[model samples]
Target: MTETQRPLLEVQGLCKQFPGVRALHQVNFDVIPGEVLALVGENGAGKSTLMKILAGVQPPDEGQILIDGQPVSLANVNQAMDQGIALIHQELNLAGNLSVAANIYLGREPKRFGLIDSRAIRSASAQHLQAVGLQVSPDTLVGDLSIGRQQMVEIAKALSIDTRILIMDEPTSSLSQGEVERLFDVVRSLRDRGVSIIYISHRLAEIEELADRVAVLRDGENAGLLEKDQITHDAMVSRMVGRDVSRFYQRTSTPPTIDSDATPILKVTDLVVPDHPQHKVSFEIHAGEIVGMAGLVGAGRTELLRCLFGVTPPVDGDIQIDGTYTPIHHPIDAIKAGLGLVPEDRKEQGLVIDFAVEPNVSLASLKAHAWLGIWIDRQREQVEAAEGIKDLRIKTPSADQIVRYLSGGNQQKVVLSKWLVMNPKLLLLDEPTRGIDIGAKEEIYRLMESLAESGMAILFVSSEMEEVISLSDRVLVMHEGHLTGQVSGGDINEASIMNLATGIQAVS
Candidate 1:
C-alpha cells in the first residue's frame, strides 16, 4: 500500500534481551504513510517488547529506528512523542477522575497569561474529539463514560499531539460489537488522512478486515509477511505459529447428544437475574457436555452468569446441581453447591495479579486443606499448585512467581487452576478466550474439551461465533435477558445463533 511512497517509519536490526530471555533478534518491519499495518503473534512472540522499544518506554539493547530515511533516537517517551509516535496501551492510561478536556491535555495544558487556560482547553479539545468522532462534551468526566467512549477519548488525546504514527494495542479487547465498528471507522479516517496506523490484535478477523499489510512474528523473530489480498485466516494462523491450524477446536470425543435422557449436571428453572427481573430463563447443561451461551453485547449474558454464580443473587429461581436444589445467597454458597465461575475480566475477578500462582491456586479450597479448619496447610497448597500447573501445562518459572508477569494466556490458566481446586460440577466461563492470543486459545479450547469429557458440565459465554460453533455441543441463545431459543446438532450455526440472539427467532 503506497509502496512508492517513502516509508514513514522503519525498524532495522532491532534486538533486545532481558536477562535469560532474548526477546527480539534482528527484528525488522516498516510502515508507509496512510496505511494500517497489523503486527500479530502469539502471547510470547516479542510483540509487547518491540512495541515498548518503539514507544521509547524501554531502550533497545541494539537497533536503529528511522523516520523518513533518517535514523532517530527514541531514547525516552517524550522523545517518541516529539517524533510523532504515540502508543495507546491495552489497559487505558486515562485519569478517570478528571474531565475529558483535562485528560486530553493533562500535563501539556494550554496556558494564557501564565495561567491554566480553561477556555483554550475546551475549545481545542473539541476539535481533537471530533477528529476521533467522539461526541462528548469536554466538561464531561472521563469516569462517567463507558469503556468504548473512553477508548475514543484516548485516541483524541493522541491526536492533540498531532501524532502522525499511532500504535493501538488490543484496542477492541473490551469493546462491544457496535463499539468495535465505530473504532474501525475512526482508524480508517486516520489512515485516509496520511497518518500511519500500527494495529495489534490477536483477532485475525480484524486483521483480515482492516490491515493493508500484515507482519507476523514468532519466538522473537520475523516469521512472514502477507499483503492485503493474501491475508486469509489460514495464512495468518500458519505464519504466527509456523503450522496450519485447520482444526483449531480440539474435540476428540463425539459431541454429547442434547436430547439424551441422561441426567443433567446443572439445571435452572424460572431463573430471574437481578439485572433483568422481568425475564425468567430456564436451561440445562448435562454432565460431559459443553453448552455455549450466545447473545449480542449487553444482552445480559454476563448478568445471567453472575446470577448463576451468586455474584449477583437472582430475584427468584431454582438452581439444581446434580439433582439437588442449591439456593446460592453468596459466592461461597455457589462454591459449596459445586459451582465455579471464571469471570470475563480475569485480572479483576479471577486472580490477584500481585500474588503468586501457588496462593491463587489454593485460595478457594483453603479450608479443605486446612488443619482443623483453622490454619492453612502450606504443603497441601504446594501439591495443588504443582498438579494444576502440570495438568494445565502452565508456563512459569516457579510457583512463587508473580502472576502479573505471566503472559495473558498463562495468567488465564492460573485463574482456571484456582477453580479446578473446587472440582465444581458446573463451570461458568464468561468470555473465556477474550484477549489471549491464538496459540493460547488452542490450549484453552483443548482444555475445555478435556474437562467436558471428564464429566464437568461447562456453560460458557462467548461473543466469537467461531468459538461457539467449534466447542459447543448445545447452544443456548439469549436476547434482552431472556432465553429465546436453543439449537443443537447442525442447527448450531451462525445464522440460527444470530437470529435467536437478536430475538428474530424465539422458541415457542
Candidate 2:
C-alpha cells in the first residue's frame, strides 16, 4: 500500500470473548480499496469471530473500526449495511420459496402509489442479476435454481444494496469446478470496479490465485501478514502453525503392490451404474492397500463409489469379498458384507447435526448394541462412543455436546467414526478432506495411514491432484463414467491423471 492511499477498511485492537474462550486477542488488520484480502487460519482460530464483529452480527470487546480513515461504530447489521459493508455467509441466507426479485428487494422494496412496486422490483433486480452474469428471469423461484446460480443471486443482492466491501465465507465450499471459475470471474470483475473483498477459505490454492495480500491468524492472535509476492505455501504454513510444514503430505515409502498370497478385500467385474451402462468398470482393492480414484467433476467417480456401496445398485456387475461372490442390492447388504462408506457431503448425507456427538458416533453400529433384539444397550453404546471420541481426538467439551456445534473437521471425524465402529474390511471415502484446514488434514492422513497398516483396504476419491499423488498407493482414473487408466508409483503425476481423465489416454 502507498502512503497517500488510506485503507478502505481497518480494524485496530480487535478483541472478542466467549464464555470460556478468548475468540480474538487484540487483532489488527487493514484492507485497501479494490483489493482481495484473504484471511486464513485453522478452525477455532478466531476468523469467524472477527468476521462477525466486522459484519455487525456481534460486538468486539475492544476495537476501533475505520472506514476511509474515519472511525465508525457498527451497532447492528443494518448500521453496517448503511456503511456499505455486506457479508455473504458460507450457508447462503435466502428465502428459497420466494421469487428471485422478491428475495433481492425483500425489506427495501421500492414504493409506488403507497404499495410495493412489483414491476419496478423485477426491472431493478434484473439489472443487478445481469451484473453478476446471471441471465435468468427475476420472477423465477430461488428454490428451482442450482446452488451456483443461487450464489450469483446473493452477489446480485449485495450489488443491489450498493455494497462497497464484501465478506465471503467459504463461497466455493459446495461449488463445482466450473461454478468456482464463474464465481472467481465475478469477484475479479467486482475488484476491477473498486469493490474491496475479504475472502476467507481453507483452500490455499484459492488464496494463491485470488489474494493480493494474506493475513493469517493462529490461536486467536495475529500470526503474520504477507504481501502478494510473499504469499507462498511454505510462508503461509510457517506463519499459521508457528513451524515449518515442509513435509505436510509425507507418505510411506512402501511399494504399491500387495503380497502375492494375500486375498483381495474388494473385487468388481463389469460394474455398471444404470446411468452409465456403456462403461464396464473393474477393479480390485487388496488387503492393506490405499487406492485412490481421480477424475474431473463429472467423471462418475462418486457414482462408482455409490454403486460399490449399494447406495445405487449396479445394472450389471459382480462383487466379491475375500474371493466369495456377494450380492449388494442395498446399503444394509453392503454393511453386512463388511463395507463402509463416508459420503462426500458430511453435513447432509453422513451426519445428523441435531444429534449429540456420542449418539452420532454410534449410529451406524446401533445393532451391535441391541439387547435381545428389543432394547438398545446403553452401557455398550456409551463405551463405544467414548472409545471413538478418544481414538479420533475429536475436540468437544463433552460427549453430550451437539454435533452441529463442532467445527467442519470435527464433524467429518464424527462421520468417519460412525463408519469405523463397524470394523469393515473395505472402506470407501469420498472427498475425505474437503473444506478442512492443513492441521486437520494431516491428522486425517495419519489416521488413514494407521488404518491401512491394520490390514484394511481403503478406496478414496479426491478432486485434489496433490492429495491423490501423495496418498494413493495406486490411482484409478475415470473419464465420462469409464475407467480410463491406472497409475502407480513413478507414473502418478498431474499430466498422466489429466490425460486419462480427459480421455486422451486409455488403459493399456
Candidate 3:
C-alpha cells in the first residue's frame, strides 16, 4: 500500500485468452516488500490464469512484469526462479522417494571432488528447515513426513533458491486446524524477513487473517481492491460475484416437516463402522429434506457416509428406507437399493477421466441399457445421456467429447448426471463442490434445492463451515466418531458447530 516507493513486484496490462474464454483483460496489481497480497475471485474469474502467468507456467498474451523497477521476461519457471520468484502449488511437489535434504537440494546440490557433497547438503538444509520452523532431520524420508511437515519442506526448498517473492495457491486446503496454525506462523515469519507473498485461496477467513491488501477479480477483470481495514466477508463476496450477496445462500423453500404420519425415507439406527466400533451413531432424513453433516476433519462425517454407501461396510447398523430394512453390504447393493453416492474426490473416485461424457453419464445405470442381459443398448444409452446433459446444463463440445477435456465444474456435473439418471431415493454427496469454481458452487446449491423439493432425501458432508450452516435445513454435528449433537434454526452458527464438533456440549 506504500505506493511512493517502487513496489517489489508489479503487473500491468496483463491479458490471457483461451479458445472460448478471455481469462484476463488489462489486469494490474502490485505488492510491496513484506506485504501479503490476497488474490480472490470466483472460479473462472482469471485468478489462476494470472497466477500461472506470474509463475511462468504459461506466457501472457500481453503484459509487463516489473521486478525492482526493471522490466523482466519470465520465459519459464526456471527463469522466474532466477528472478527470485517461486511458486508453491496446492499439491506439494516433493518427491516421496527422496530424503528431505535431497528434495531441498535436488538439482543444485553442492559439488566436491566431482561428487555431490552430502555433508554440505544436510548442513544447508538444516538452516532453511529451521527458518520454516520444521524440526525434522534433514535425512528424514519425505514420504514418512505428515502433510503439514511436507508443506514446510516445500517452503525450505523455495528459500534455498534465493526466493524474494512467494506465490502460494490454496496452501492449506488439505491441512488440519493445527497444521494451518503452524503454516500461518511460517508465513508470518517469512513476511517479517521481507519476503513478499501473493496468497490465493477461496477461504475468506484466511485472507482476512493473513493479507495486508485484498484484490478481487470477477469475470476476468478487476472488480475491486480493498485495503486492510476495508476487507470484510460481505465486501469480498459482493466483489467476487459482481453483486450483493446478502442472500447468496437464502433458501427458496420453507423448512421441511416430519409429522407422526410421515415415514423417514433414509434411517440409520445404531450404526457402527469398523474403524471406531465404540461410537454408536444414529440419524434419520425424511423425504424432501436436505440434511447437512458437520464436523472437523477427523470427526467421522465421511466415515458415516462411506458406511451408508457401502464403500466401507458398517460393522453393526440398521439402515431402513421407507420403513423397511435394506441391507447394503457393497456399493452395487447400495446402488440396487436406490442409493447414489458422490464421493469426495471427484477425479479419483467419481470419474474416469479417459472416458467420454456420454459413457460416463451412463456408467452407474448400465443395467438399464443392458440388452438381453449381455449386450449394451447403444441407442438407448445415447438417448438417456443426451437427456442428462440437457437437464444438467453440462457444457461440452459434444456427447462424445472426453470428460477430461471439460472444466472442473463440467466434470462434476457429469458425475452428478451419472447417478441422477438412476433416480435414487436417497443421494449422498461428500464435498460435492470441493475444488470447483464459485459459479459452479451456486449452481450445485440450486440443484440440491431442486432435488429436495422434488421429494428426494439428501445428506451431504462438508468441511467448509459456512456451506454447511447456510445450505442445510438441519445439521448433524459429529465428533471423534460419534454423533455429538444436532443443530437447527437458531443454533447453526460457527460457534455452535465448532462447540459440538470438539466434544463440548452445545448450549442449544
State which candidate has the highest TM-score: 1
Which window of 10 residues has the lowest lDDT sum in candidate 3? 242-251
Write the candidate numbers in order of decreasing lDDT.
1, 2, 3
lDDT of 2 by residue, 252-357 (tens): 6464467777769998999888778999999898988899999987789999989888999999989999999999899988999999999998888899999988
Across residues 1-508, which tens digit of lDDT does each residue of candidate 3 receive? 3454569999999998775557899999888889899999876678778887888898999989999889999989988999889899877899999999999999999999999999999999999999999999999999999888999999999999998999998898778899999999999999999998999888778888999999998878999999999988788988888777663466788667779688899889999987789988888999988999988877888888889999999999899988889998899889988899998878779999989899999899787668876788789889988997898888776798777656677889999999998989999999888867566788888899999999998999988887898889899999989898899887778998888999986564
| Of 1 and 3, the candidate ranking higher by lDDT | 1
Report every candidate's CA lDDT.
Answer: 0.90, 0.89, 0.87
**Which stretches of model 3 miss by more than 4 angstroms?**
1-4, 96-98, 107-116, 143-146, 261-263, 323-325, 354-359, 370-410, 436-438, 505-508
Reference-based TM-score of each model? 0.92, 0.88, 0.87
TM-score for candidate 2, please give it: 0.88
lDDT of 3: 0.87
Better of 1 and 2 by lDDT: 1
2 versus 3: better lDDT goes to: 2
Which has the better TM-score: candidate 1, or candidate 2?
1
Which candidate wins on lDDT? 1
C-alpha-based local distance difference test score of model 2: 0.89
